[model samples]
Target: MNEELSARLRTAAEAHQPDRARILARLERGMSGAPDRHRESSGARPWPRVALASLAAAGILAGGGFAVAAIVQSPPARPDNSGTPAAPSAPSAPWTPPHTTPPAPTTGGPSAPDRSSSTSPSPEVSGGTVSARPDSAHVQDGPLWSAGSLDASSNTYWAQSDITLKTTQPLTALTVELRITQTGAVQSTGHWRTLPADDFTVTVQPEGAAVVYRWTLKPGRTVPAGQHVFAGQYNHAAGRREAKHDGYRVDATGPRGALSVWGGFTPAR
Candidate 1:
């Protein structure tokens, strides 16, 4: 029985030894494979990271190049059929103002008749009575008188004519007409000379009973009846005087008859 038991125990021990050897070999192989797998995994992870970094760099470079190209290039211009550049538009014409004509001057009213050309009509005389006649006839039968004198000493004088007429009837209207001329003589030579119309002035004042009516002379042109109207100077070195060289006449008209008187003077020698 002891021999039999020993045989069984030997068989069991042999089987158990073979199984333990196989398990230990398998564990050693598994341990060595685990380090190789770890190295492979770590290497593979670095490859993926390098590829991502290269892609990102390439993308950045490409984006930067595209941005530079966009910045450097200019916008395209429209094509023109004509080769010559379009002429700059002409500057607008300067504005011009229109010209206007001036109006003519206006005259106040109708012009007066020119009396400087011809002499007035002469007077008519009968007995001691005298009357003013039209230009057609003349009558000579009355006494004439002279007033004042013109000499070298009399350089200026205000010569006046006053007359009292004798008539059969009372006189309603009377006019005294005096004709005067301006004369001057040089102080050194004493040569007498007559002044121009502008150089001297004449005015009338009615005595007795008569108011001045409208004047026969031009309106607004004649001097006032009592004021001094200066005639232009004939000679700068000459003395001037109011001379009645042409003489004066007084006419008194009434219902009975018209009476007139005349007077004048030449330079006294």
Candidate 2:
């Protein structure tokens, strides 16, 4: 009912045009005592009252026109949809799978080694690989289990020769010698043996144009039966040096007969 009444009001306001001049002229005439036909035909209504009524009606029409203009200009309100739930947020990111180790990257050349895929590239052989087992020689058999090799750290300027001996029986006497070929400016730098320092005599000397490092057990000093090392260190000219001509000798005597072993150093593979 209210909406219908508002519609009618708006229509009436739009159809009728208020005339200020005509209304004012009528008011002046009425005020001057000129009879108003409508007022007389209807019951005697004062001119002032009629003028006020006209003004009130004009004001009402002006207000209704302004209200209609506002209604037309304003944007429509959005319907309330907060009551409806939002679409289930994209299924909450597909259940993430547990982390797994990634595969190693493949290559055209030998695939770069991967610790995850295989074992870490065997720890880089330092300078080169040095065999731990000695190149066996029956030069003079002894309580065997002895080995020798050039150290892996050997480079152009320096090198180390290692002799590892594992004696099965105590020794009453022992002697070891390592010779370095007389290459460019070849010179003995040092020598070491696992036997107690005071138990053996160590010497590094040049013999017949070759530098020889020797370790000899002192009289009455019983060489213990176990693994022992006799390493000879030397310096030579700056270049890759080979120990093909270099050699070592080990002689020992225990409760059994005296025995000895001699062999040449093999270039590290």
Candidate 3:
């Protein structure tokens, strides 16, 4: 029984050893092929890594191009002493002042005459008479006139005459003379000479107005002789009359008498 058991054990051991050898062979083949697969996987891994890196580099370059385009499109910066950019300045307007107006001018009227150089009044004469010789004659033997007595009539008589003197000299003196006579009744109580009343007036008609020289004569009055005997008598009537052309007039009033008048001028030197 023991021998039979040993034979059976030996046969079983032989069978198991063959099966185990086949399994070991299969494992060895699998192990040898593992290194080749690992090499292939490692090579494929490096290609994926290189492709990812290239994609990342292209994205970075595209971003840099966009940044440069933005910088080129923007405006240039103004320089300042500080590091900051300056703001733009606004435009200014013109300046002006307020306005004003001026005033207007005034006007006036005409003026008056000056009274400081007016002439004075004439002086009175004494009863005496004077004689004068003229250097030149103005009038001689003018017509005579008469006035009746105051009892017969009260009418006054006047005569006027014009004469021109020819001389190239200045005259300083003027004289007038008259011839007088009396007529009509004479008595012891009232003689014709005693009863007659007479008045004589001589006038110089210069350029402007008549200037009068007067004498009141008695029946037989005497006259003194001189130059410029009637010099200061002017405007004795205190009135103005029209002047003749370089001439004069005689005016007489009496009760009963006849009178004749003559006049001339004297040279200055």
The TM-score leader among the candidates is 2
lDDT of each: 0.37, 0.70, 0.31
Clash pairs for candidate 2: 134-147, 134-148, 140-260
| Global lDDT of model 2 | 0.70
Expressed as tens digits, the lDDT of each residue in 35-141 for candidate 1 is: 43444444244455445555655664455445444434547566588786875778999999888787876787877778684443555453443322222222221
Mark the regions of model 1 whose C-alpha exceeds 4 Å error after superposition. Answer: 1-170, 184-237, 240-244, 266-269
Task: Give me the candidate number with maximum lDDT.
Answer: 2
For model 1, the run of ten residues with the poorest summed lDDT: 225-234
Which tens-of-lDDT digit does each residue in 14-56 have in candidate 3? 4533244443334434544554344444334445544555565
Which residue pairs clash within candidate 1?
Answer: 130-258, 199-231, 199-232, 200-231
lDDT of 3 at 171: 22
RMSD per prediction, one decimal? 29.9, 15.9, 35.3
* Total clashes in model 3, counting residue pairs 3 or more apart in sequence or in different chains: 6
User: Which pairs in model 3 have colliding backbones?
Assistant: 129-224, 130-224, 131-224, 131-225, 148-255, 149-255
* Off by more than 4 A, model 2: 1-136, 139-142
> Residue 204 in candidate 2 has what lDDT?
78
